[model samples]
Target: MDEINSVKIEFLSRSRNESFARTAVACFAAQLDPTLDELGDIKTAVSEAVTNCIVHAYPDSLGRISVKARLFGDSSLEIAVRDWGRGIEDIGAARAPMFTTGGDERSGMGFSIMESFMDKLRVRSKPGRGTTVTMTRRIASRADAR
Candidate 1:
């Protein structure tokens, strides 16, 4: 495998940026020869993460979100979504399936969906600072592997 290639993009915390985030990851993963399933999984995970940032991150103030994608030598892709808003107080509870904060129409499944679709998921948050979610997925090489 070759060295990991990466792409980074930053955007405002707006609903319109969700499509941009998904497309960015899809375009980058295409270079790695990811399968259709792999691409779909990446797109879903990216959408969930980006949506969470737009909805939860900065309820009162405006901020920016950053997304980074890195294609590993093993054909696995790692994506990191970050936001500088009110950080998560309890990552453990937030990660629990169907656990969401008050208000909003969210199903509280963003983190869960990300974890289920990706090979690995990591969350880092600091109250009053920000939160960062990192997700990784391995691309299948052959039809039998699918």
Candidate 2:
């Protein structure tokens, strides 16, 4: 897809930053003129991706997380959340519904939720390096909705 606009942000992998990341992405996506439901889906997917970085990627200590968002000419938005901490050993298992390494406190539905809400989802990681989750959603133009 041809890129229309893009933004990248880096922040500490703290629980508090999850909301910041979510809102930032939502704001960047505003130019697409998304509906409330579309905005909510983007925010939720961002929250899950950032939360996973804070809770799972760096369980022992704080780490760096990066989020990059891009807009395409087709009105599609792509968001990538990355963490520079411990990476997942099994990407397949992580994406499975109800599979969680977060113990009892987590429901392990983050990936599944992201997949359901976005048009495309991709997860990449190296066991000792880090993990990156990229998701895209297409915003229906106002005319198309009518």
The numbered model that scores best in TM-score is: 2
lDDT of 1 by residue, 1-146 (tens): 56579889999988888998998889999987777888888999999998888888887666899999988788888899999999999999999988998465889888889999998999999998999999988887676466
- Deviating ranges (above 4 Å) for candidate 1: 102-104, 143-146
Clashes in model 2: which pairs? Answer: none
Q: What TM-score should be assigned to candidate 2?
A: 0.98
Rate residue 122 of model 2 by lDDT.
94
What is the per-residue lDDT of model 2 for residues 47-85, given as tens digits with 9 covering 90 to 100? 999999999999999999999999999999999999989
Scanning candidate 1 in windows of ten residues, the lowest lDDT window is: 137-146
Model 2: worst 10 consecutive residues (lDDT sum): 13-22
What's the lDDT for all of these models? 0.89, 0.95
Angstrom error of the Cα, residue 45, model 2: value is 0.2
- Global Cα lDDT for candidate 1: 0.89
